[model samples]
Target chain A: MKELSLNILDITENSVKAGAALTQILIDEDASTLLLTIADNGSGMTKEVLQGVTDPFYTTRTTRSVGMGLPLLKLAAEQTDGWMKVESIHISDDPENHGTKVEALFHKDHIDFTPLGDVVSTLLTLIQGHPDTDFLFRHSIRGGEKEVEVHMDTRELREALDDVPLNEYEVIKWIEEYLNEQYNGPEDAEE
Target chain B: MKSLAELQKIKANMKQRIVLREGSGDIRVVVGMATCGIAAGARPVLNELVKDVSEEGLSEKVTVSQTGCIGICQYEPVVEVFEAGKEKVTYVKMTAEKAKEIVEKHLKGGQVVEEYTIGAYQS
Candidate 1:
């Protein structure tokens, strides 16, 4: 993907398809390094499934033969002189605690590093497409006068929404402005 | 800065509209967003569809969502439209511009843009 946000969207789709009720997308970045973590409370994979996940030929899907999400993400990370890792515990193995966590670290100073594009749009798309599922998004930047963070949890929104759906047009629009305002800061928004 | 408090105001406002239209949308716009599709640029197409649908006031009648691969990787950025009483139309290699045109002509004007369909590209 041209933007790392696209990769984030693609990987998170896997979690949704796996029937994850809650997914957490966390990002931590500094001047030289960026870390992205997508953890989902979904039906985790078997050992064999985990082993083949990074292979472009391996896929749990019946629609097509190839699964390119993990492979492409791995390439993107490694090309930036960084790494990617996956940890999972299948439901068959441990029903109480079964989920998947994918972490990709990229050295932002490297020439091959991909930009984290409009992530607000990515989060909105996720909410719009899968309104029933919940998402927790937190993005933090470390190299500033003070650490800055942008946070959102659907669990909290769901409580506030009551019977209204999260994908309601006004809800989505409000979220877009909310996130953009956060990213831009109140002072910048005033300008 | 925007806050969650404002979402409350929106929730209150949307409740009236929701009660007026209780059922789901009659048409569905599904954008393919698998690896091939994203790498080929489906995000912009999706954003355009969502923006256009809302701006054109077609939100009540149409729903724009996303899906995984349709097993046609060659046609990287594909879009499928489903109407209540019509055949599914697949548009391939779509861009944001084309998405806007589709929204205006096919969605708003009730006339399909035949040249953008998969059949036109193949034959």
Candidate 2:
């Protein structure tokens, strides 16, 4: 993926395929570092599967023999002098709490760091593709003494929307504007 | 400063417009979004479909979604369209421009863009 947001979208698709009721995409960025954590309450992988996940040849899908999602993400992180880690608890091992968490740290100062581009569009695509699943997205940037955050939880929207689908054209448009507004902050009317 | 409170307003408005419409459409547009597809630029194609469908006011008559790998890695970024009484049309090696044309011609105009289909690409 050219952009980190595309990587985020590709990885989250796996979570949705695993039947995750909730997926969380969290990003914490400073001047020099960017940390991405994607957690999902889906059917987790076995120890063997987890161990082989970073390998480009490992995949659970019958259609394709190779899975590039995790491997590409690990490559993207390592190229920036950073690392990627994945942890999972299989459904058979712990039925009550089973899921996967992928965390990657990227040094933004490195020359090979991939930019996080058009994340708002990525989030909208996820929601539109899987209306039944819920997503919690939080992105925070720390600069000096100030911290700016953009947060959204689909669960809360579901409660407020009642029967209206989260992927409804109007609702998705509202969400896009909502996220954009947060990023832009309070616009100056006078200027 | 946009808040969840605005969702209530949308809910009220949507309910009146779509009182009993559960599943929106009879036509399904499925985009392959696997690693191969993403690497080959499926995201833009998917976005183009959604944007055009909504803008054309075909939201209620069509549904655009995504699927995993279909074992055709060579033909990444594939799109399949399914209608009520017609055969599924698979479009391969799709770009954003091609997707827009498909929406306007096949979807809105009710005629398949045969040159973009898998049959043309394969044969």
Candidate 3:
């Protein structure tokens, strides 16, 4: 759970720095299942780049960039008694079609993505910091046969945040709402 | 909480004012947000710029933006300012404190912090 939150924060930072115009996040957690994905329309990587990114030794540079975040995410997803996959395509040729997609799925093994909450905090942090960029966050949790999407009204938390840019204090509060939506929503909010 | 949709209002307002500000030659605050920039904490600087500028009602005359790596990673998160018909000034190793100084000393008083600029390093 804690690992997932850190993964999200790290991935989003990569998306922003990748020169993405828009970044998308989809997190669906139900009592029995959890599916998470982060996608970006940034400078896509080539097949070579994609193959290398997941490598622990892979990095953007030899200095300052440890390049651990994405790979760590891959690890958390795959090790979480679930499934994980990553894909990317270079958009330089057809810029419109270029994008990188990363996914992590957790099933009933109860790997627990409940801790280290603050998805909204995580998402909102990226959005607020990069006003020049656009981001979409879609989250859902399972019910019976349906998935309930907990729509948070926390975007307005932007104004109250005042001069702070996703500070730890504010981020903690935002995470609370995120946890509620994922773990505390109606039995079947998706339907 | 604000709706993501309401960001339209911000955009709409920026659109309407962009032309006026450009024509009128307002002070533009440019933050270095390249990979080096964000990793160096450009996010907080950007937020401070947005919030302070708005709170001070300086939004009409000052605008904030993000840019990619400037190859000057050692000096990031840098901020540069371009005023009408003036030489560009780049501030290196900028924190919230330095950002505010740029606002008060340069943006408002029309005087560059010659000591804190990239030129300072070149010298």
How accurate locally, in lDDT, is each candidate? 0.90, 0.92, 0.64
List where candidate 2 sits over 4 angstroms from the true fold.
A144-147, A186-191, B20-24
What ranking of all candidate models by lDDT puts the best one first? 2, 1, 3
Worst 10 residues of 1 chain A by lDDT: A182-191
Instruction: List TM-scores for all candidates, in order.
Output: 0.96, 0.94, 0.58
Task: Give the alpha carbon lDDT tens digit for every residue of A1-191 in model 2.
Answer: 88999999999999998889999999999989999999999999999999999999998877657778999999999999999999999999999999999999999989999999999999998998999899999999998466779999999999999989998888998899888878887565443
Error of 3 at A161 (Å): 21
Residue range B9-47, candidate 1, lDDT tens digits: 878988989897779698899999877888899988998
Residues A24-49 of candidate 1 have per-residue lDDT tens digits of 99999987899999999999999999
The complex in candidate 3 yields a DockQ of: 0.05
**Clashing residue pairs, backbone N/CA/C < 3 A, model 2:** none
Cand. 2 Cα-lDDT: 0.92
Evaluated with lDDT, which candidate comes out highest? 2
